[model samples]
Target: VNCNCDYGCPCQFNARPTDGTCRAVVAWRIDSGHFGDTRLDGLHAVNIYAWPGAIHEGNGSMQSIIDERASDAQRTALVAILQGEGADPGAVMLQIYRTMCTAAHEPLYEPIHLDIDIAERTARLSIPGLVDSAVEPIRNPVTGAPHRARVDLPFGKEFRLAEVASGRTRATGVIPLELANT
Candidate 1:
C-alpha cells in the first residue's frame, strides 16, 4: 500500500486513515502464485484507488495495471482477482477492498518495473503514466540518521508484519493518489 497514509499507518490496524480518507496504491510482484489453472507466476499487478472518507465508505474509484507479459489466461485471472470477482467473500485484503469500490477504470497491460530490498527497508515500483512510488528507511529529523522501526501484526490480513519506513508516491493517472513521508 502506497497511498497517502501517515508513517505509522493507522489504517493497517483497523484505525482510521491518517488523513481522514484513504488513497491506496496496491501493487505486487508475484514471483510465484496461481489462480486455478492459470499460472500467475512472474506477473505484476497494481491498483490505484481513492475514497472520500474511510475505507468503509463505498463509491470509490480504481485503476488497475497488469504485466503485459501475462498470457490470456493469466491476464483474465489476474484481472478477476484484482477486481475481487473470483474469491471467497472477504478472504483477502483485495477482496474486501473490491467490495468498497464503485468504479474500476479499464485495466492497463504494460511492462512493470519493481524492486524490493527488505533488509534495507526500501522498494521502488512504477507503472508509467499511473504511479511512481518509493520506500526507504525513515530518517531522524534532527540528526538525519536513518530511523529504524518495525510493525508486527500477529494476526494481520494484508501482511503479518512490516518494516516501518518513509515512503512517497506520485499518482498522475485516473486515481490521482499521492503520499509523502509515509
Candidate 2:
C-alpha cells in the first residue's frame, strides 16, 4: 500500500493520527492466488485508499481503483477482497477503511505501475494523477545521515515488517498518499 501521510505516520509513534486523519492509497499485485476456487493470476491490482480522522473514527472516505485489463470475474474477485471481505479481522487497511470512510469514490480502471525491492527497502507505485508514490530511506538534514526504522507484525496482514522511511508524494485524487526513504 502506498500512503500519503506526514513523513513517518503517527501510527508508528503510537500517537494520535497523521494529517489529523489517515489518507492513503493501497494497491497490490497478485502474482498468484485464488478467490475461493476461481484462479486469480496474471497481475491483478487494486487501489484502496482513505482519509480517517482518527485510528478508530468512522467517517472518512475511500476509493478503489482496479486494473483495466482484468476481466469481469477477476474484477469482482479483487473488489470483494479489497472492500473488506475475505480478509482477517482487525486487519488495519480493510477494517479501518470500511468503518471510517464516509464517501466511496467510484472504482477506476487504469494501468497501474508497481515495483518493489523489499531487501533494499525500495518500492515504486504509480497510478497516474491518482497516485505517484515512492519510498526510500530517511536522511539527516544537517549531517546528511541515513536513518532507518522498521515495524514488524508477526501475524499481521500485508508485510511482516516494513522498513519505514521518508518519501515523496503527489496525488490528484480524493485519497492522499506520501512516500519517503526510511
Top candidate by TM-score: 1
What lDDT tens digits, residue by residue, belong to model 2 across residues 1-182?
54556554666656666557666656677778988876778664755555556646677777788877888887887777767777667765675567566777777778888887767766687887777777666677888776677777786444577777766656677665544431
Q: Give the true-structure RMSD of model 1.
A: 1.5
TM agreement with the true structure for every prediction? 0.92, 0.80
| Model 1 clashing-pair count | 0
Q: Report backbone clashes per prediction.
A: 0, 20
lDDT of 1 by residue, 75-100 (tens): 99999989888779879878888888
Which 10 consecutive residues of model 1 have the lowest summed lDDT?
A: 1-10
Each model's lDDT comes to 0.84, 0.67
lDDT score, candidate 1: 0.84
